[model samples]
Target chain A: MRTRTLYMGMIAALIVVVGLVGCSKKPPPGEIIPPPEVTPSEMPQTERVPGDETAPPGSAAEDAALQIEDVFYEFDKYALTARARDTLTRDADVLLANPGMRLLIEGHCDERGTREYNLALADRRARASRDFLVAYGIDASRLETISYGEERPFVLGSTESAWSKNRRAHFVVRQ
Target chain B: MKPIVHRFSIREPEQARAHGLRAGPFTVALLFWAGVLTVALLFCADAAAPEIDLHGTVVKRTLYRVPIVVEDFAIEASPGERNDPLFFSGGERPEDLLVQDLRFSDAFQVVRRRQGSFDPAGEPPRDIDGALVEQPIQARVVGRMEWDDERLRLKAELIDQGTGNRILDREVAINREGELARPDRWAIHRLSDEITRYLTGTPGCAATRIAFLRESRSGKELFLVDWDGYEEQAVTGLGTILVSPAWHPSGERIAFTSYHRGAPVLVALDLESRRLATLSTAPTPAAAVYSPNGKRVAFSTTAEGDAELYVARADGSHARRLTFHPDIDTAPCWSPSGERLVFTSDRCGRPQLFLIDADGSNLQQLTFSGEWNDSPDWSPAGSRIVHVCQIGGRFELALIDVQGFGWRRLTVGGGCENPRWAPDGRHVVFALTQAGVRNLWILDADSGNLRQLTASPDHSYNPGWSRPARERIRASG
Candidate 1:
């Protein structure tokens, strides 16, 4: 009987201890448990800003009505083809019609070469176009040349048709 | 009660002996007290004993990733302020930027707590056992963003989970005017680099910037971007073709080939003063690189009717030809000691890598395996040369030892070229094309880990990595 009483007392003490531990005070008010890091949200889409010159200005549509054709070059060659010279002759005629107009000849290349080398080649192409216009009785001061290298393609696909269109010197009119 | 006492009472020694009993209550009480004393002594001994020191043997692994936890950022707005204007609408948050930087570092495995969880404001827990529950977080980073009247402040703390000690705490600030003038990414980059240094014992690449060519409708202009691809800005707005941008060792200037005057010429731009100075007066000058000491420059020019390498003072004076080969020699990269150069030449009937003394004495071919190899850049440690090699009509990056042995191809893709080594000598950043779209990619030299650094829809090529400006200053000092 004495042993049974001791066992009952120990069981009661354990129950009280467990109850006390469970009823412990809560954390202080206004304390926040920091959230986990590394939430994988969707990546923001890159949007072109309004004054970014990723493409030709909207005014180029009006200039395209002038019927001045862009000049093309052969693959890996900056020298103008015979057909390219013929196109430049007509562009020179357009420049002659408007003496007050200044022309920006943007040299471009197809996406098939190294960037730095293509840059040099495009520069040569632009200068070639400028030289042809200067020799065709157009004022040299009215012509400025820039090379876009393989950047700013006229078409997006990697086809021969697209590459042929991209490998050209486009003329833009500036007043 | 009297009957129970009598029943429980112990007999005397003579009565116990007769009854075959061992002892009475006195002896029993004594033995119980002795047992209690022994247990108490054991408890005392355990409390006063010193802890055992354990030394573990380390096993070398091919790759070891440090586990780190990034806590959600806290915003502390100033009086009357509602939000931070520095962050773009729907763009990356401050914590996002930090996480991106850590991920690209390839040194840490970042863990994030559940979304919308609140962090208790105050000091972090004082012991690893106190902070961790289920995850194996080795380190934790907590950040707070404070915005007040045109000024933005970012405070970050790096805590070591093992010791529960705060390893680093840094605060960065940027003004509204500065944000409008330049992207505020630099401040975050500086903090990220500090955190990396605290964790890895070496600085991170966040402070390094890359200069590449961006195609504008008018021309291809040189542009600059931070290593994380933020702060995209034009370095030169000359409305002409520019290429081959090479950063000076000091990171204060850049030399590139520009066609502003109708022909290619080497031009140097001072980043701070925004001054443009022509470096080459020749008709065609391209591919300029600075010596390791930043005191001299070497470039290729066609003034002699063929492309040949030339060396000049940093100020573009005292120019002299470095190579007299009849074949074309371009893309001259100076050795780290500035005693020799590795350049591309076609003297062997095709473009190949050749090494020559700084004064143009001992000419030796460095590559003979590839039919074409060009754009050779010497490693910062002067132990290897990385160049673009043409194999099966596709361009790939190849690394060759300085002693001309152990040639290794680094890129699995055929459209990788123009590999430039990082200042740490363990990473190389180069241009890679996939599906005809060119972007910049970085590769780890030892582990062969590859990561795409840029993901712009437009083409980004000709990347030039900068040395950490802080490290450069420390070294010079």
Candidate 2:
């Protein structure tokens, strides 16, 4: 009975110590960037802000038209989830709407795996998005791909909430 | 023994303090007891099993550190020449560096004069019966340095105390040019390695170079430094993402993945010519490693929408796919014999190490314990594979034999990654993160001693230890 009590006490102490260490090691919260604009046809168009005076004509309109949502993946996985496929389907609609727009599909991963493996995984994630769009009738020539690996993280933390957002295929409409 | 225990106690509590936690003495004592219990259990479990000799095992073995008396080099001036102050007023003295190298080698422990004083340059005492005096020392090293015309010359000798025989005599000269025109400490490094080789039969790692990636605000770039982490030289400034820097067998070229042209590509850089060549055939290549013979290259590419292992000639011709997995298969490292490769793949549902023949036959899984394992580098002896294993949600360096019988974690406190073996096969250089700063560290495989090789503020990782220059010279000579 005494041994059991000591074991429980030790376990509780270990948990407390580990909790403190883990809390202290949390990466400082980074600048929170808004998620990519998901411009579904059913949604109301957002009002253009008043800072459009310095922009070229029609470029702002093109940027708004090319706004597509980013598709995310699980840890160390490149296979698109069902939600990811739906997002890419909507992304394909935006690509089809803007015929002159060329999309740069940027694959990114969280800071977890080895750099080399992460780079390759990121490439696969980007290519998966591109392949899905092409299969959805978007022209193959309209999309290009690049992998930032873990070098660029969308959200800078090791938590699952941040990692889920970081592991994604980000879209940038090239001019 | 007391010092060792004190070091452990201090290091553990200090690491806890670095986390901003107020670990009181009671907490520290509890933690130490917990650690001791855990280690005792592990040791008991591991000791119960008989040794397995499938490949070179990281199994615990008895360490025999040779006791040697090392003397400060006697500085000698050339006949009729002034003792130049220029030679003395340089960076690190040769004798100090030799002592540091000997200590770092872990094969010899320098006996302090307090233990038993002896004249290293003087002859040993002989009894009246023509027998040598009794001493605990096994060997002695003595050296002298003098200024030759345009170079500084160092002559060293290693004498065996037991047999009273001279084991080695060597001389090294360094030219006085480049970087303040100082006598290069590399001459001392060469002598240390020579002495170590003559005594231990295996070359020391002092005179080697490690290629690693240094991250900056712009991007990650390749940098080269000595084995002792001096003379930092930037090899590439592409201002783009670079990873997996690999040294060719000849130690004259480096291949790495670069995102210079908007896509990941395998690029080779010639150190002497400052030339870069892209292996254009590989689509989105990463983790390019040269074969043991330097005639072939194995790399991972995404030519078919999914990453797969591919092999080609060293010049990037006659490319052929070596794996047909739909799952992600990448980071292929060549075995010592170049007949097979050990790589990471997710075909097993999670990332695990898999070994396959060069012709893509007889594929087998090598690790099944870790949740994730990747970036395996085969040791030069073809016996062990060191890789990054995820334990407790943190990456640590782990070693496994070729036959997949043993699994051993080499580091603790996590944040260890990208392990590569030195040419000596007894030392491993890997990246370790502490207090949020990543630096390069070396692990003595035999002694399990960890030493930081680089402590830069910027992140440094992906270390590739090159063949020691002395070995190349000896091979050619």
Candidate 3:
């Protein structure tokens, strides 16, 4: 029994080393330094990145610089537009190429209306994007959803330009 | 899914105005304050009756405001404690807070006069000499401060200038345990509330606490501040996003939404024990409010696909769904009777207020003029409902009767939202943003007067006014 436990520890260590080597081989361009390994206890400091347990040690930096595009929506709308559908189509291709990757889809809204209503609207936006990807042959278990309502914004202004940028569905690679 | 039902006819903006005119102003005032005397008696339960007959003016919605003046507090420290730093420092004076508390009630127009210091152990003679030329002062308040047994005691008196009758005489004391260098705010607030009750027929909101959300470096968290926006303290330190705080009727627990575990969930925090118990783990739980009786809770969640309303026991068992709309239907606020709820829905193309029975029947629409209306809070007085109405692309505070009689805007130029009525049902605390700065302000809907509550650089919103806790009366019988 003790021998089996020791063998399990060795296998986990070998898997971590292999994952780190594969991540360092083709680092995304403009990413010279790798991100420090984040433990579960240090999750509060990096709030935007909620989950990083199953991914490689330095995958947080790579997740931040992912090549996937975000899907945008109009005011008080979650129905996919032609442009949003096209963007999600390309995002689906990226997911198909990386079979072992999992994604966390974040839905955000502009700073208008009541906070609770904005939360419900943003949830619909994230679910709408996830459903689109699932229809394009992506595994349903690979996608998870969360909505920030109007609390977190990409831009900080009340103008139309800033508001348009804020109403979007952002993607982060979890594994 | 239950089909959408419309019980009342959808009237145009012009037709609604005509209906309001036919109903008349006296009926509107009568319907608005029909429950005022009952609520006032519950707050002010003393043996002696009101000194003056001001209920007629209050019940009829007259524009008559009592003119009053507050005199500087006299210092009568014991001989050995004369030079104590507590009485000599230039901090927040008890008299200044007393004046602010009285002015915020909107029942009095107050002027502060600091005449040359008075004799510590003597009483000043009374005279009817007019102070202001525009309006003669009709009443005045005087206070005396001293030390006894390592505690601060303040003796306050209210004098009616019209008849020179001493209406109220009260004494408030505070311990020396917390912040001995300055006068105790709780004592001064108690004195202010006592005086307001004798002068006006209604009690003041000075002694209550407001629970709200304040922005921090990490994220938004729950905070508790006095009704006058002093002594701000954080109640939750999870360093994550929190929203929509609702106080239990007993003022012992607060239910709000917390995102500590990466998804929004409803939880209740007991102020006395500091224990948090999860109420609902449904998908996207946004707004949760306690019923008037505190036995049940009504909230909005998207557990079954779209945003819907649910009613559950206080311990979050025996859950029952209330609404089944495909479009967004959320933000459920209960009536004082706890048998019905009013929520915001977008099924009518734009967000508007909708009323439904707790058993999911007899659905009716409430507002007809605004392009968007949301966040409806039923008044504790059981007559009016206050909400946010969008007029010309700006959000402003508006009020409507429960029976859909009168619809009027309380503020102009917009930028107002999340309005919650005080226990007195006359004042409203809401968030107002002007020129990129957001702060909380209390509005007197009856008189159109406003007083600023918070002025922090960080934004503060989602104010939840707690019911005034019952304490022993300190006024003369």
Candidate 4:
């Protein structure tokens, strides 16, 4: 009778050990194993985050409160007109309202000139807008400029309407 | 055949006296007969033998297209081997590319075979028989393609039909086959170049490449494609605007202007290592071109407020401004001798091409008739310049001699820009835009024959042609 009791106890111990082994096979919740090491040459030089730099900052309500319209220019001209000045006035007011906010002025051109020349024209257009903002009491250091140079068109067409819409200084909010 | 007899008579006076015979009439008749026989024999020998003229004639020859026949390549497969997918899909075969190259080269008039038009199911004939030779096939090309596991072997031969002699024979191996793959195209291109070399004294541009700007989703990226527009690949993924790719003399690196850092900068990218090196850190640097020796670079920069031309070492050191005009000056191209530069400047109130020395001394205007002219590329031989001219509100390609003469228009309809010369100096590749679509086209500079090369959905422009890679390597070594 004592041997029979000891065999039952041994069987129970074996069952407990087996149960422990099976439970240990799987990892715990939210646990992760590291991946293999990769050589430096195999890694990408730049981690690209598409459209992140151009994305609008802050909550939806705050973004809605900031209204900075794009300024348009004449064909083959980078100088700002009266209407462009009015738009920059409003953009400068928005920048002044939020001290922590920064602005990226994107200069674009129509598809009517050489690519290299258009880039230079776009730079002048972006500087025109930025210069206007700086004159309207906005800090110069808070502004950054880039020229897309007929690469990204607001409207895809060759008509005057489309080209006029494409030749503009687009405003983007950054922090 | 003719035979003659010689006669002789004993006409001595002593002999006649001893025989007691008169020698007047008989001796005269024998002498006449002997003389006649000797003249007859001389005449016969002279008529039978060939004559030789001591003086020679000089003949002038002109260049003409060589006529050749490019037969459809045959596929050799075992009984149980599966046919190559490219053979039966009605797609571009290797021979088709070879024929296109031969035609585009303007060096040959390719004649086609009438019978056995590329049958993938039948066995390839061992030799080109008389029936196919009866056509206008002056020279014939016979090829055999076989498959072993994953590898493909191609054996091509160029035969002179008149002599039945093989002018060229080559074997090529390709490890993979796909629509986007390049090995098959490369192998066929190499073979085409060999055929061209065999027929003409100079090698063809089939093995060269062209670098251009292809519009992508994010921006314009630098892309490289074979001369035939077979292998198209993006070289720069900076996700920013890039343009004006200039191939180094070694054909291993390219210098281009990129906007990766929110401003224009000149960047050089090593093709093999896929590494990028910044050559210019100016606010707006564009139109970078390598010198003939590949030791210096000439580019246009806007860092000094107005756009001006600048020169620096190939590593972007010792930068010196070349143009000091307030107006825009850009699009710098080096002369073949690397002693002069042709650039587009607006100092005269409108954009026009100007010539300057390497040290920026000889500032002379090159173009005057056009209201706007830009993108001037000096010929490889340094005798002419091809640039884009705006006429009637449409940009067209125009060629001008180095002496500022022979201003001939090359393109007729549609807008064409950015004309680049092949290393052979006989062909020009430019971008043609029509109805808001842009494609690359090649033009035979001599015959003015136009052929479309690339049909990409995105716009392609600013083509830069490279020298033959093998020749460049040999030259560098």
Candidate 5:
């Protein structure tokens, strides 16, 4: 039932995102900038993003939109669990539906690991989630990954419960 | 033996005179009234009056005598306690409280009273015993215990055996029924510390813990450890890039940064609950931290594409931009008082020490000699700031007093990067490598005696000392 709700949100996010195919703007090489004005109706009718071939056009209208319920990890390990797989599948569907959708899989860990190592571990974890989704047929280009390490914890207690919740990978919608 | 119950204060003499208390003869009038009063009343009045010194002694080591006389030491029991014969398990009572403390200090050669009655005035002999080569002296630790409302109070004292004089005294009045009451172990440790101070003029380890960061190829994690580097436990295990773990006003929580996702975001991890909370990830990731009580943190960020200094609460609130027109300001440490922040900035062509207020005012450059001085860890007593300054391609831990003077080297030119203070402010912990083996080492905050803490397994990179949480704040407040 929860996945169903997430699917609904994914569909809504896709409809709006697919309308932004290759139309998804990016800065020129070597500069960091945002997408400029592009009409939803003017989006290319190709199977992929016009300028960005990595995007799958009209996939947002398919059964590709997935839902993910924050997947958490153990103390310092970045490998996802069986339960985390379920969430990743949902997120993959969302990425698959909107070829124009670029995702930033933010990896996170609890406050039990070192800062630098956790950053790398979180990156691995985020990549783990992204790799699984891509293997499930989602385009890698549309999916971006980064790690915040144990620096950004969702919960703020030094208890097992808090640590469990903090060691996780959070999904964020990209422009 | 009694303490000379004489009260002297800045306002004592004037107040005593105003109250018509003259120096003629306080004992004479008191004796005259005591003759008409009962013994209990007489004792009560005398308890508050100037106490008479039946005996007093102070221990001092001599080139000739290791057996320095110590005063105010005695042993006593209240009906039944750890020392009762009924609890004796071996040659002597294993649970004897004072005896255990006496042995732990390793300062004295304790001699227990013989089974015979104590000869209060009988001298043992003119010649010292040959077997007693160390120190030949007797100590008596007396504890007066009372129970009230289910709580126990123990007032302790120590003295020289021969003179029966008071040398040192302390009290542990515990109300064990409440949540705030400390554990018996804590009280015992405090008691042991008082004894050490009484003998050595300086206190020994009793109330102390170590904080360190475990480093690995994957990520660096923060850990809290005992002084012996035992009981080591990870505090922040967010397997991401972690840097500069600082004890919050509450030692139970720590403020640090973990690059879990993208940018270096500041986080606070509660040591007890193992919970992690992101304090700030918006506007820009928190660079450094001073807790909400005003402990300043040193953060690395690029507000202008060059990493700069910004102070924020350990909880990620009440932040203020501390440096402007900066080259690259980072690593801000809060003085124990939280009034000033010591940090590193490249404002002078390279990283050097800088001082500023919590609100970003009172900006002043601190280091003039070092080419690069980074990682400023403010002393727990607000006495000095410990940091690393580059010296001929290598870095050393240097401590600059609060006045930016008395700059002294803590670690000789070596691979020391970070310098953190122990709770008692006597030692510091840093990371160094030999033969390409990186490890954490502890150093005397005064003498700079480098002692390796963690050798193998995963190299200890950045070590953060854990100051007691409540004391961290009270020390600053």
Candidate 6:
């Protein structure tokens, strides 16, 4: 049993090394230099990328130079899915690498719920994502979230497809 | 919705002569107009959009269209020649008494248009139509008015917006001296009110209601009382921490938060049955409310971290967050049409109000004063929003127009919190804790009349008025 545990640990360490090696080979366009002896929790505010106070109406990656995936949640639940976890991972990486970058995680609900509850639930979802990012190492100070509740939907119809697209966490770039 | 009878006004005395009617005929016309007013007042019912009951029985969900009345400047006259003193005519004719009356009525929930500074009543001159208002609705009023002689004439029509059919077109006379010293030409005020009755089938809600919270024992209990401080009933018997009580659109149930059970949780209780159910439990107490369509509930919670907004079902399922701010983000209220929400946040420093589309895409800052401004409750007509604005030493209720202009104070008291609008949107109820005494108070939307509610001997707080139920049926517990 000790040998098997050791083997699993070795594999995990190898995966981390390979990932770091890949990062070094293809360092992102702008070299994000992490502060010496810096911890991940202190990364967001320290990396301080020039963020926009108001992001323009341009498509997803406009103001903060951060790319967020379409966060999807299971029906009747506000928990972030594996895909959402992976998407938020990108946000965590961006914050960890570029300390100046901040995120506004806006939570939304499908048109199926009540307005005030949806607002609270959307807020919870946004906080859920914010907590995940923080747990993974992003600075808490540089992040914010707001709940639009069910007031805002990505789709217009009442169909399941529209609801699926609506029950989501959207990333907004805040300067 | 046309007036039961229309009365023509006698102007220049010659016009009265033109009909070959003697001066004595004026009284007969006046009596007829009074009869019309009396009838209109008796039959006009609260005007709500025809319900389609699309989601009824299952949840028994029934949504009414936002009542919209389209009234322009005109002298509404009951055809024929005899002139009556009750026929209304004021500044710029129809723009005066009749138009203003339409805007003031309870049943129709009149939505008027802006005809520039030309409007006689000094109404904000902003269009009630256009992008400023949203929501699919059916109730509306359209009419016109004009002035002549020492008398003013009003020709007005109330029409259903969804269907361009004339609800009512009545001519009422306004006697200048008898009306001017009074309100909107007193003679015509009564007559136009009757016209409104014809349009709505229910008398006005002007002299009616207000629901607010009365704080006692340091903000412990929440009570509901009549607009005039009578029959006080505690909406919350938690005997613990409770605040922020709001009426559902239907006014049948109240949505609020209570901390009696340790953590703050959302709950809705049927006003008649007292059957209460817990929706969700949070680390701290927050505000919750039903959508305009009565489908969803928007609330605030701190379950994850700092306070933030969330949404869920009436039965408390499918919770989703709307904000991710680490700062205080609380109090969510839906616009009357349920397409948008206005809430309070400390994100921009002090507590200020903000609006977001129902889809969570468009975010806009609404209030500028850095002081604490929270608890936004939109008007039933979607024309205004009432909120609590706290200054250095003065806490007062404030009103902002739908266009976000014309921020005005509705109260100047020191401890007023959570301003809730009457169904007619012309009256507001709120909590006031002053001089170590806590009580609920009501304010008339126009005159700002003060009506204090000391309903109980206990330190009552947080009023959640059930909107006056239309049928007053025996609901379930």
Q: Best DockQ goes to which candidate?
A: 2
TM-score winner between candidates 2 and 5: 2
Q: Candidate 3 local accuracy as lDDT? A: 0.76
Compose the digit string of candidate 5's lDDT tens values, residues B12-110: 445667988663343333432343234333334443432223121111122232233222323343544533333221334212444444443334444
Q: B1-477 in candidate 2: lDDT tens per residue?
A: 111111233356677778888876567567757675565444444333322221222234446766677766777666444345546543446677777788788777665332224664566544222445444577877778777666677778888877878898877665555332234467777777887888788888888889999887778888888887776677676667787899898888899887666556787887766677776445678889999999999998888767899899998888899999888899899998999999999888889999999999999999987799998999996589999999888887888999996777876667788899988888899887754667888888777766778866568998899988765544211
Lowest lDDT 10-residue stretch of candidate 2 chain B: B1-10
Interface RMSD, candidates in the order listed: 22.4, 14.8, 26.9, 34.1, 27.5, 30.4
Cα lDDT of model 1 overall? 0.70
Model 3 chain B, poorest ten-residue lDDT window?
Answer: B50-59
Residue B266, candidate 5: C-alpha displacement in angstroms: 1.0
The TM-score leader among the candidates is 2
Kindly report which residue stretches of model 6 are placed more than 4 angstroms away from their true locations once superposed.
A1-175, B1-203, B206-219, B455-457, B471-477
> How far in Å is the alpha carbon of A172 misplaced in model 1?
20
Q: Report the TM-score of candidate 5, chain A only.
A: 0.58
Per-residue CA lDDT of model 6 for B349-429, tens digit only, reads: 666888887667577889987366777788875578888777564556778875779897765445666667765566666
Ranking under DockQ, best-scoring first?
Answer: 2, 3, 4, 1, 5, 6
Per-prediction DockQ scores?
A: 0.03, 0.16, 0.11, 0.05, 0.02, 0.01
Name the weakest run of 10 consecutive residues (lDDT summed) in model 1 chain B: B51-60
DockQ of candidate 4 relative to the true structure: 0.05
Q: State TM-scores per candidate.
A: 0.61, 0.77, 0.75, 0.68, 0.50, 0.43
lDDT measured at residue B391 in model 1 versus the true structure, 0 to 100: 79
lDDT of 4 by residue, A2-58 (tens): 656655665575576556544543434454222223234533245333225543457
| DockQ comparison, 1 vs 2, better candidate | 2
What tier of docking accuracy does candidate 4 attain? incorrect
lDDT of each: 0.70, 0.76, 0.76, 0.74, 0.55, 0.57
Which lDDT value does model 1 have at A113? 54
lDDT of 4 by residue, B1-477 (tens): 123334444357677778996666546456545654555555444333312121111111233667676777787666544444543234556777888888778777666553246332234322222222122345778887888665778888888767888888887666553322556666676788778878887767887899998775667778788887766666766656777889988888899887666556788888777777789988778888999899999997768766788999998899899988877788888888999999887777677899999899999999997677888889886578988888888777888987899888876674787888887677889888754667788877766766667766568888999986456633110
Error of 1 at B150 (Å): 6.9
